[model samples]
Target: MQKLKSKANAKANANVKNSAITTNKRLYTERQKSHFLVHSVACLGTEVHLAACPLEFNKGNSSTGACEDGMPAVVSCVAGPLYTHNVALKKKLKVSKNVRLKGGTHTAEGRVEVMRGGKWGTVCDDRWNLQSASVVCRELGFGSAKEALTGARMGQGVGPIHMNEVQCTGQERSIWSCHYKNITEEDCMHTEDASVRCNTPYMGYEKTVRIGGGRSRYEGRVEVLQALPNGTQRWGLLCGDGWSTKEAMVVCRQLGLGYANHGLKETWYWDSSNVTDMVWSGVKCTGSEMSLTQCQRHKVFNCQKAVARFSAGVICSETASDLVLNATLVQQSVYIEDRPLHMLYCAAEEDCLSKTAAQANWPYGHRRLLRFSSQIHNVGRADFRPKLGRHSWVWHACHGHYHSMDIFTHYDILSVNGTKMAEGHKASFCLEDSECQEGISKRYECANFGEQGITVGCWDLYRHDIDCQWIDITDVKPGNYILQVVINPNQEVSEMDYTNNAMKCSCKYDGHRIWVHNCHIGDAFSDEVERKFEKYPGQFNNQIMN
Candidate 1:
């Protein structure tokens, strides 16, 4: 009986030991799966769903179902201490056009409006001051707030009072990042809407550069304030020689204007200021320099033409447009077309036909047209809107769209050496969405007086079959040549990168048929590729033909 009891006790102990082993394995598996989920959630931030994290059961078990149990596996996650901060780092706050200033004459001044939940609202002036206002100005890409006006000095804003008692260190990227009190019923009203006048470079550094004796603020004689060796400041004219867009850009930048459209060498009509002492001469700039003092200059006490009429001038713009061509599309879309001369009236009017057509023998002959499609894109952050207001857009009865700009894109057939042989261009292109990527919708259309512009992430396509989409190559001899397309040729708008605005293609035309190859973005390729592209195999022509 004693031996039987010992065996019974030993059997009982063995059974308990087996159960303990199974429980321990299951616990180990659960712990591993939980750890994996937590790691995935931490890496991917709040966008990850806990259940979606990858896991495996019985992964290291010898048998397929060794870790299987009647109970289901469960995991509970407690966000780690670093989880909140990690999530914030993973997500970026989008800066929208929700915050805007209104009621001021210029874009840099106005009453403040904060867009909240799809509704525009106002900010109370309770604690609105220069620091808080500076945050708004900087967010809009301007300098800082010059004056924080109270009592709706610019004008009253409507809608909900979104914030009050706002505070800022004047360095926040957006107003939403600044601390502010949520609006309450007793907090404020539209009459207390905050207003601000941003501190533009024009107002702060007026002594540095100034425009005078022109019809508008945009056009004027350029004058610089020079500090004499004796510490006295004197305003004088800039010598017109070597004055070009590069020097004008520095002046516009110093004045807070967007860009320089034209740098006038002789502002005879704008010489109303009559301050004829030429102090700055041979002013040369690389277009990226910040101010006139930073540019290379020759100080001169006298000039041969020391008259205010010969002073340099600039036409400043609030913004400049950028146009870029799709070289890939141009390469694949080349063809030859012959249209009747009578049907080329509009093309002739716009100078899209060859120079021979402009002679007295004009519409009597048909010309061989080198036709191709053009895909113009505006990759700048801002929309490439027309410089003129709606009133100035010309009505084009042929294209059934209003022409906003007189010169938009230039098409030129050049010699291998750069001499222009044949030229054609599109005037007043109707900006619209030819196509867009996923999640982007077309904003501008040419129909029914619709707003015209290439919105961000949109493109404008001029098909090869469209009228005037050709270079009149009828009189050209067959040879190797270069095809160049320039957008925004007049620099009517501002762009982040003007270097990428042109595209080129290598062409071999035998009079009857043309072969276009080796097309590329103007500034996209490396130096090695460019050298290889311009290289000739057997013979090289040093002479340029036009």
Candidate 2:
């Protein structure tokens, strides 16, 4: 009897193990993979990429299955979601108009209303623009219209149209009459049925409006919290706090997140371990717009599993602000005259407009005053020398300027790399500006031939034909050679492109050192050769003189 009981017990144990293993597999697998069921309006060329069988939302595949057309699905495969949820969803829309109005005229306020029972009703011209028109046309699913008519809606009750002046600068129009001025003979535009016909060439971005609201939290322990406009509080870990603006910042030097205040834009540090198996739960802000946190939450077991899978957790929370960064500033003024040099937030004692002296014609040099309005945030570093290019320094300067100024911060030749190279020498260079005092890292770029084939401005480190070429310095004895590195970034490279693919050159020697004149590298150019990889794009050329 004891022997028999032992055998039964072993069989039961095996069954339990099998059940546990199967349950674990299900928990880690993507729950909603490969389930497409969209049936709203779709036009030609509207792409529908399929997801692989084992694929799932956020998680990869559970089981492989043949498509209706009989094809195998695989992981990381180009096919889209294997299963789709809420495919029946559609988008809401609105109408807009771009009628030309006289600059100073109040009657040209771009707007119109519908006429109900001969009574004209005006719309509250809110968030009006071409994009709004695009949505309306897409929703209607008609070929999208060229223009969203305003002001010409069926005339609303003839008296003073409350906000009648529909101000618009018909972007592509040539005629003054193209946009409805206070009074234009163009009768085709009636002031009643403010209509938007669907005349779009194709359908894309139709889902922009359909996106609901919510907040997204990063994977980390909540260290600080701030009350957002709505009832919910915005939370963040030991990194920072407040809405996208400069609310607050936290740092634990031990975690490699050192203390820095000015440029909170690039700072990111999180502890992924604290994240529970949570689906993106959307939190409701005052506006109807849904933030990342506003999304629905995940199941309990799934959340725990997710947290466990990532030993070092990383969480991302949503913010309302979309930040603009690393913008290039070019100097528009050519002549250098004495003028008021100003910075943002400068104390009155330091807030004086720079004045320039008059030319030879004046009895005495007349002073021209330039008022300094605010203190400039120069938060970047400059690179003096780099290898792989003719010896030169690449200087880069960056900072956040005041919002109101139409003015821009540009590169002023503090001093050129005047290694005394004659006009038109074939050499590549790199340069940068820095914010070491502000705790920000180094930022610079190389100069080489660019897309248009000019050997001008910063050249990406790759593509030798356009990058730094080692100079033949044997014959040209080295003394204190004066060289100049100029920087002008090509607008073509985007932020992502710079981070992922741009090239950079670094060197061996740094700071000030002395050497005898004519002491140079044999097969070399500049005796100093330092090398470092740069992952950011810059606004100028990279050149160095050893």
Candidate 3:
């Protein structure tokens, strides 16, 4: 087995050594049995070919006379593109308009939405067919239609129904070029939104991109291999002028990383990689692109922060906590309570009640509270922990616990048009592994100054009986509203996914009683099933989209 492994490694090493010899891709050379020692003064000092450099090795007892920077000595010529592993790279994608994919886990699949009258709208599944879907696939530069999905298979789209009953011979340049019906309100609904899965050619784009100068593979400065018209290539940097989450999302996705924990604009701290030049600038993405090259960028590299230190960087993660609320728990444990203000002194000190409670005839009158149980589950690949350390946690005498974050979760009531009616925030004083999966021991507990975090496959539940677990609905009018519970609302903590963080339920309150229904996490139901999500779309949120 050892001999076989050694043979395998030797073969791999030969490929790398040959790559170095046939191309001027790498300069930091170390002696390997498979590598030929080479000396190049002109290639190292002056910007010239290796052939122009001296081909002699100085006679020396010490190792430092002929070879500088520990480079081995030989006589040979090497030339080619940067890091060309005898493979060809695909061309960069051009920005597309009129039609684009959205809400897909990756770029190749998404609901078949179209543009009309300067507004985006969905295509109905009345006659959704693969032939028509193939037209969209070709229009977007992909190979062909893998599948035609209907019944809002991608997810519910919010907009006008644009087209229906589409017919295509599959040779059209665009889906719009195919025979399709213009949408009308009476003809279709979002529930019948059409979607498509496309066959995308393997571009090996990830091989041409990398993160450099980090402590681990999970982070560093952004670098991309750029090819020239002459066929030569070089590793280049990305201009950091407006780089952030959306751009980082595409990058992490392209790199096969889970998600972006932090997208940094400047990477002076990780200034180690020798790659140079700001090859791309003004890069924009909708968070659905499968690769960074698929995102939009300036026609020419135009960046004020052209220096290397100001280049884009990213901290990615293969595993992160995904916080999801138990919508069913919220619905089952919701109720209205009228408690006298005198019994709420501790709650008042913690600012659990709304401002109206402050002006209420304290000790004499009662305030109405809408309470519910919130069971937040860490249904991701990593543990759910606060951003700050315990040393920074704030202690509250009223709650007898240390608050890991000032605001960890939010409870809100919204009107029909999405206007905030009433709201309350949870000061997470005790984020612990309330319960864990089978065979997993608890790692975090709030009692006796224990650590704080929700273990993966575990859940941290806030019962309705807990303090500050209720929304002060004292001034809320008796009517229909949406009750939304968002954990990690401010994004103070990183997660595998955030779309599932906000759990909402429809509520109808009639002065005396309240009913909560249709409670679910975003994308959990379909006219709502889904696979991808972000805070904003077609706009910027710590990332440039336009």
Off by over 4 Å in 2: 1-236, 239-333, 338-411, 414-546
**Global lDDT scores for all candidate models:** 0.71, 0.24, 0.74
TM-score on alpha carbons, each prediction: 0.51, 0.19, 0.55
How many residue pairs in model 2 have overlapping backbones? Answer: 128
lDDT of 2 by residue, 1-546 (tens): 999999999999999999999975765464334442321222232211122122323222322332323222224411111111233422122212222121000111222333222223333232334434333333333322345554332111112222223333323222122232232323222223233433422222122111011122322332323345688854332222211211111111112121111112122243233323223211212211112222232332232222322211222221111001111111111111232213211211221111111112333332221111111121111122221232222222222111111111111111123222221111222223222223344344222321111111112221212211111121232223322112212211111011111111221111222121111111112112211111111212133211
Error of 2 at 544 (Å): 24
Clashes by residue pair, model 3:
525-528, 525-529, 526-529
Please identify model 3 stretches exceeding 4 Å from their true place. Answer: 1-200, 207-209, 223-247, 265-268, 272-286, 293-312, 342-351, 355-364, 528-546
How does candidate 3 score on lDDT?
Answer: 0.74
Clashes of 3: 3
Model with the higher lDDT, candidate 2 or 3: 3
Candidate 1 residue-wise lDDT, 1-546, digit = tens: 999999999999999999999988988776554222122122232111235346444444243354432333455533222122365542442233768775453456777888665446779999888878878877765666778888866544433688899988655778999999997777787668898987553334445888888888887988899888998999888888878877887787777676676688899886476577778888889776556877988754545677778889998776544456778889899988777788888777767787777773555768889999988876443567776766899887765667788988888888866788898888765778888756778988877888888876578999998877888997789898888888877656555445667777788888889888666666443444445455541122322100
Candidate 1 vs candidate 3: the lDDT winner is 3
| 1 or 2, greater by TM-score | 1
Query: Where's the lowest-lDDT run of ten residues in candidate 3?
Result: 537-546
Candidates sorted on lDDT, descending: 3, 1, 2
